[model samples]
Target: MDLVLDAPERTRRIHRAAARFCAANGWAPLSEVPLPNGRRADILALLPDGSFRIIEVKSCARDFLTDRKWTEYRDFCDALLFAVDADFPQALLPEDVGLICAASMEDWALLRPPPAHPLAPARRRSMLLRYAMLAGLRASAAADPEAGLLARMALRLE
Candidate 1:
């Protein structure tokens, strides 16, 4: 019998596996990262060598088919990948993007490696700064849930 999980649950499982995979490969994975083009990536991984990878999680065929912003993410990272459940039809995914299949949070396998295209120096610098700032903000929020509100108030007072 095939087990089916809801979209949100499947996405959460994919993220957990992606995080573990990134850590094992010497990358720090950040979730829900805002991109310059006003897009938010599901997972953005920063490598030790200053490069980055973006992973978009697709829970099912409908999710993948309905998304039109995936193409825009290529300009923001050195590599791009799609994370999906094992039951997803992999053949439907783009050939250019990498593929990862995960049955659950503890089980994930890379089906294909993404082709690397290094970002321009200027873009890399800007993205690195953004990544650092976002990471810092997230850490702060974790410590103090009201940090965002406090920061906004401080900005207004300035």
Candidate 2:
């Protein structure tokens, strides 16, 4: 039988499944936490030494395409892990980002470099931060372009 769920419900299931996985893996689950650079991440995790990592969870149909924001989420953290449903084809994910299948809270296969990723680590970090800032500005601009200009200026200063 095909069990169809709404988008929000699917996302909630994904989050819960990931939370269970984190707990099992000895990682502490944290709600929205501010990054060192002032950006807020969806989930912040603490390692044994107290280091941190960020996770961004997404839920879509088996054949659905990823939204553009996926790129922005990668920038705001040391590493990026995506929690997705198992039905989605893993091939759709980009190289360099970690992947976790949410149904069983299991670490799905990691996305490997198809033929070696060209961007250096430092360059990727910079790109992610810039993309995130632009994304935030774009959201603000949708409401009010003047506010977006101010937000963009403030982000640039930081």
Candidate 3:
């Protein structure tokens, strides 16, 4: 029997595997990053070479088909990819973008490499700053749950 996970479970599993893949590859992965363009990237990673890679997570076919915003993420990163499970239909994804397939909750592999679309200098600088601020903010909040409400009102860089 095929084990069909629910949307949330699938997403969580994909996120865990994607984060691990990023770390092992020397990339810092940030989840649910709100971009300046008002797009919340599923995984926005800061590559070791100072470039960025945005990974959009697709829990299932409906998730991928309904979301067309992934196209807009190209302007903010050096490469864009979709992170999906082994069951996801690979053909539904665009060939130009990269692909990450999760074999299990703890395993992920980058199946396809993305073409380079270098970000404009100004945009890169801006994204770097925003990424830093958000990462720091999240770290602070996690380190101090008592400051939850206070941290929420600290700043809005997005």
Candidate 4:
């Protein structure tokens, strides 16, 4: 009999594997971070000293070559990582970014650092908070018209 896995179950397995891998490697990984431009990262990991890394995980039958948004995501992060379970040509990944692959926690690769700029923990935190607030504002506007109006009014008062 052929075995098949559901989407949620497969996602859970992949996430669990990633969490274990990160923990074992002494990296802290956070999932589902909201970005200012309405882009959300699947995982944001912090090195021991609090350096930031963004990881994007994909598990689809289709190839990554056709994904336009993935390229855009690489631009937003300091370091870009593509995590997958199946074998896909690493040549598709840009030379600058890193590639990580595995079926379980045992097999994972840490890609090299992004092009030199600067690594600042405080600056990253500031950026993160700003992104969070912007996302919150968007959510508020979507959920409550009164809140959105009040927010704009308060901003004008300031």
User: Top TM-score: which candidate number?
Assistant: 3
Mind sharing the TM-score for model 3?
0.92
lDDT of 4: 0.61
Error (Å) of candidate 4 at residue 64 is: 2.5
Query: Model 3: per-residue lDDT, tens digit, 1-158?
Result: 96777899889999889889899899999999999888899999999889999999888999988989999999999999989998899999989999999777567788999889999999999999989988887887788966744765766643
For model 3, what is the error of residue 107's alpha carbon versus the real structure, in angstroms, after optimal superposition? Answer: 2.8
| Cα lDDT of model 1 by residue, 10-99, tens digit | 788878888887887899999988788888899999999999999998888899889879999999999999988778899899899998
Please give the distance, in angstroms, between residue 19's alpha carbon in candidate 2 and its true position after superposition.
1.2
Q: How big is the positional error of residue 24 in model 2, measured in Å on the Cα after superposition?
A: 0.6
Candidate 2 backbone collisions, by pair = none
What lDDT does candidate 2 reach at residue 143?
A: 97
By TM-score, how accurate is candidate 2? 0.57
Q: Candidate 2's residue-wise lDDT over 35-74, tens digit each?
A: 5455655565554544345666777644236355545544
Error of 3 at 92 (Å): 0.8
Q: Which runs of model 2 end up more than 4 angstroms from their true locations?
A: 34-40, 61-66, 105-158
